[model samples]
Target chain A: MTGRLSNKKEKSIIEAARKRFAHYGFSKVTMEEIATDVEMGKASLYYYFTTKERLFQAVIAVEQQEFVREVESILQKNILAAQKLHEYVGKRLRYFQELLNLGTLSVHSFFNIKSVFKKSFNNFEKQELLLLTRILSEGRATKEFNNKLPKETAIVLLHILQGLRLRTLKKIKGQQLDEKSYKNLQKEMTLAIDIFIKGIKR
Target chain B: MTGRLSNKKEKSIIEAARKRFAHYGFSKVTMEEIATDVEMGKASLYYYFTTKERLFQAVIAVEQQEFVREVESILQKNILAAQKLHEYVGKRLRYFQELLNLGTLSVHSFFNIKSVFKKSFNNFEKQELLLLTRILSEGRATKEFNNKLPKETAIVLLHILQGLRLRTLKKIKGQQLDEKSYKNLQKEMTLAIDIFIKGIKR
Candidate 1:
């Protein structure tokens, strides 16, 4: 009972903190404000999260988990591998845009704390690679793909996606990922994936 | 006669500055040092180039011109489109590695002056797009490539290459682009180009 109650308390804290951070940004939001919003003592909030960065990471983790769950569902769907790959690209772009819009940090701030967030980013990449590998393997197994090296292709694809995102972000430096730019990026990514699909298709 | 002599003087100064900057980096190397190396007075160096930054830009322009000349020569060669593309990719990687190794600026310093260098970078990209479009168009005209939108494909390809480079640099932040990483990048880029070639082939 005590464990369950503590979990509930932690969840509420994270929820309160997310809203605060999203509204005011990571540097602007304070732990005391979060505690006040959560109706918890500052000391109790500290017990849950040692630092604001830690809390920010927790929020990001939750968001990442949600994205993974969605991707996993798509993976489980009975569909053509090509369709899955397209869906993955579309979802990946949307998720990334949403993440950029999280308001907890601007694009510049995110880069500023890159070292602090490197661990989470690495974890996310691993998860993404596994998901992509499974998709590629499925396609090959179904004889829908002719690529002899699914794992290598998956790794390359991941790097390509990351590179594309970085380019877009750099182009719009200091500004939020606006709708027009997002659509432009979406179109280019979709086309790039189309070419990749053709390359690997039997 | 005076105009020609001035042009020659400026060229010599730029050459001397390039050598100094490459050896000592931008911060360590001074305009006075470059003037001394070129056997000119500080006033004469100022007449030729206003600032260290301007001299750095001149050096970069010269390097960019050399790379472009090499690429153009490859374009003029009698070869299959596939071979030409593979050659282009190989040359691009090697040239970029050389640029990184110039010792004139570390990756971190390059990023620090990103805004200042934006104009030169933009010019290079425009030149690259034009060259890539030519290749794609040539391939299409010969019926060696099937891509319908040569220009669009060129733009996407440029972004992809940029993205890949950014990802690699991020992976090795704060360190020089070492030989091993260069080899790894070369391998991955070669494979990427192969996939791209397969995608566009007739």
Candidate 2:
């Protein structure tokens, strides 16, 4: 996962695999085909990814990294807690759309790998819940949000986000996300966040 | 779909298919096997369902019937709008658990036949939204709830419900719904309803 040459090779492998897997799906794509596409011998590809599943996991993890980075930056912003909540939720929705478009992950894909990646997914959710809870706590402290149930509220907010993500992804199954769909997706996301803001404001 | 003999035959087929599909998933279960279980000729089975996909939809429809009945009953209740919303959401979560336990339908199964059953599912959701919107509208009329966007709020609530359903269903994927997980699911559902109630109250 480190050193310049090794990193470059791994990145190319993942990039190639993402396209292959997206087009053919995880079950259809083969390790030999990935190696040939990457112009690397089969053995070297195995050196980076022990199996087809591991390669899929690596590709998914790459997607998760971008999400984590975006979330961390939003959490560190010096802004009102309410404003941060809005921004965080918007960014979360956008990334989800991107994820579906890229075919890096979706509800179906997640379900397919649920048992394999349960611990990793749960940890990622807990981290996200922690950040949201912090924002709610800050909002409560500043009297911008009702303080009685910040922790519980954050968790529910995550559930709602998951719901939106699942709903949107369902719409996009076996279809492409287009310009018009983008507008509608944004409109729905904004309305949900507005409702949440209404609910949270003191 | 009526008449005692006709209804009994259809019910038997659905019951047998549900058991087969739940134990082996849609991909593994076959029309011939379902017919054998029902002790009917394979050709006669086709009289009920044109294809395996149609049979799957019928099995899912039976599950949908129970859910629709529950929602209709809740909507007809003489209760405050806020209380009605709480009850509707609680019932929604309970039905979702029942749905997973029945294994008659799932996010994955839905995705698999999304194109085939899109119309039916859309109609079902439209009815659900209409009921929720009516409740929100009544709340606004009585000044018991904020009502700037009744229709949109109802839609978002449905999305959140989908989220909780997806979350709960995801946990039960490739596993059973253990007792502790059920308690946690109930707790989470309660918190989500409390937040929604807070958000809508004037």
Candidate 3:
């Protein structure tokens, strides 16, 4: 029971810290601000997090873990590779949208964190690339995808999704995208996917 | 003759400032550093460009203008839409790669400047979108491209290119990519173009 309570407290602290860091950036945010937001004493916050930077890193780690879990779940599902790839793109976009809504994913802060956590970030990215590569290989083997370079096509697909996320951040903030815009984006995405499949088709 | 010399001096100062800003970012870079690089006193540097922010903006303006010109040239060339789009993608990628090599483009700093120049950037994006829409419309009219959502497709296409630029920066700085990686990127880009054309073909 004590362990559970402490875990909850830690989670709450991390959530508050993520909001503060996202709103003010890592350099501008202070520990006291996080404490205030979490309705905890500064000393209690320190007892949980130790330092502001550590708290910030913890927030990012939590988000990354959540994203990984989502991707892993999709990968594990017994779906066709083409379907898996499509879902992968959609799921990743949804994950980013959730982060953006929570104000936990800004392009500027993402790059800053990448610099500080270069090794970890690179490893995480490599894992994603590997997953994509595997899916593309499966698609190629099944003759569901056009014949082309799987690795290169995977990278291109990743970039297209990233670009979509970035543009979404620019246009819509916390508000859910309207049905019309969502449909338009979906159609465009489907078109892009179709193009990839056709380009490589035998 | 005096006016011409002053104009030359201004250009030199801006060039020096661009190098400094690109290397050190806007906040960390100092006017003294730029002046030293230009072999001039700080006061003389200031005379040519009023402030560091203005100098940074000027550098951005020059790059943006050059990019616009290159894109415009590609658009104006008498070519099929499929061929034109292919060339445009290749030229844009090559242009950015050159900028990266010359140390004139930093993805991190560009994001910062993007926020500062949001209005002008949007205007430029809108202009590019308009150009793309025209080309796409022509492609459809001539039965070169299938009648897909032209504007939406254009947005996705642009997003993919931009995303590729960002991904390239990450791979390069992280020491995870090489020249061969770029060739692979080009291949994937061609694949993407081919797929789009195929999907839209009537």
Candidate 4:
């Protein structure tokens, strides 16, 4: 019962911190403010999270878990592999946008917390690669795609998509992502995916 | 004649600064060091190029001009559009490697001179887009590729390649690029280009 209660407390702390960080950004949000918002003592909040960066990371971890779960669900659907890949791109892009918003980070600010973000991102990237590999393998097994090297193809595709995401992020610099920028990214991804699918078709 | 001498002096200064910057990186190399290397007084160096950043930009501008010239030469070769693209990728990757070496920049250092670099890169990107469009249009004209939209396809392709380049750059962090990493990037780019060609072919 004590263990469960501690877990609950941790989750609640993360939840409250996420809102604060999202609203005012990582730099602007304070642990004191989060503690006050949670109606907890600052010392108790520290017990749950050693630092603000740690709490932000926990929030990102939760987001990453949710994203992976969604991707898994998409894979489980009985759609064609090409359709699955397309769906993955759309969903992945949305998740990226949300992740950016969650941190409210500028390019300069991103560097400040890059080490923390990178730690979380590396694990998420492994999950993504596994998911993509599975999609390609299933596509090949179904004979919906004829690419001899599914894993290799997946690696290339992921890199291309990442490249696209980085380009869009850089173009926006520190500005809040607007509808036009988001739509342009979607359009580019769609075209890239279309070419990828056609290239892999038998 | 005075104009010609001034231009020659400026070229020599940029040449000297490029070597220093490449060997010692931007942050470490001082204006005095570059001036000493070029046998010009600090005041004289300032008269030609006011800041180290401007001198570095001039060095990059020259590199960019040379890279464009090489690409144009590749385009002039009488070969299949697919072959031209493959050659372009090979040459482009090498140029990217050189650019990385030219600055000796870590990711952190990159941010310091990012505005200056971005100004040069933006112009280079435009030229790259136009060249890619021309390749696609010519391929379509010859019935080697059936894509209806050359410019759009070019945009997507450039974005993907940029994504790949950024990914590789990030992987090395601040470490000098190794042979293995360079080879891995080459392999990935080769696979990506093959798939791209297959996708766009008539």
What are the Cα lDDT values of the candidates? 0.81, 0.76, 0.68, 0.83
**Local distance difference test, candidate 2:** 0.76
* 3 versus 4: better DockQ goes to: 4
On lDDT, the stronger of 2 and 4 is 4
Over B1-202, each residue of candidate 1 has an lDDT whose tens digit, in order, gives 2353358777888788778766666567778888888888899889877877777777777888888999999899999878887888888887776666554335346555557667777889899899999999999999999999999998888888888888777777645688888887887787778888888988
Docking quality of model 3: it rates as: acceptable
lDDT of 3 by residue, A1-202 (tens): 2353359778888887777765565666778888898898899888987776567667767777778888788878888776787787777666654454444443345456556656656766787888888888877887877646788767666766665555555456534555666665666667677665555555
Candidate 2 lDDT over A55-149, as tens digits, reads 87777677777788887787788888878888887888776656555454433554565576666667778978988898899899989988588
Scored against the native two-chain complex, candidate 3 gets a DockQ of: 0.36
Q: What TM-score does each model's chain B reach against the true chain B?
A: 0.87, 0.77, 0.72, 0.89
Give the higher-lDDT candidate: 3 or 4: 4
Query: Candidate 3, overall lDDT?
Result: 0.68
Clashes of each: 0, 1, 5, 1
Off by over 4 Å in 1: A1-6, A20-24, A103-116, B1-6, B103-116
Say which candidate scores most in lDDT. Answer: 4
lDDT of 4 by residue, A1-202 (tens): 2353358778888888878767766777889999999899999899888877777778878888889999999999989999999999999999888877766454236445468667667778888999999999999998988999988898899889998988887778767778999999999999999988888888
Q: How would you class the docking of model 1?
A: high
Residue A138: error of model 1 in Å? 1.7
- Is model 4 an incorrect, acceptable, medium or high docking prediction? medium
Index of the highest-DockQ prediction: 1
Tens digits of per-residue lDDT for model 4, B122-182: 8899999998888989999999998899999999988888888878876786666789999
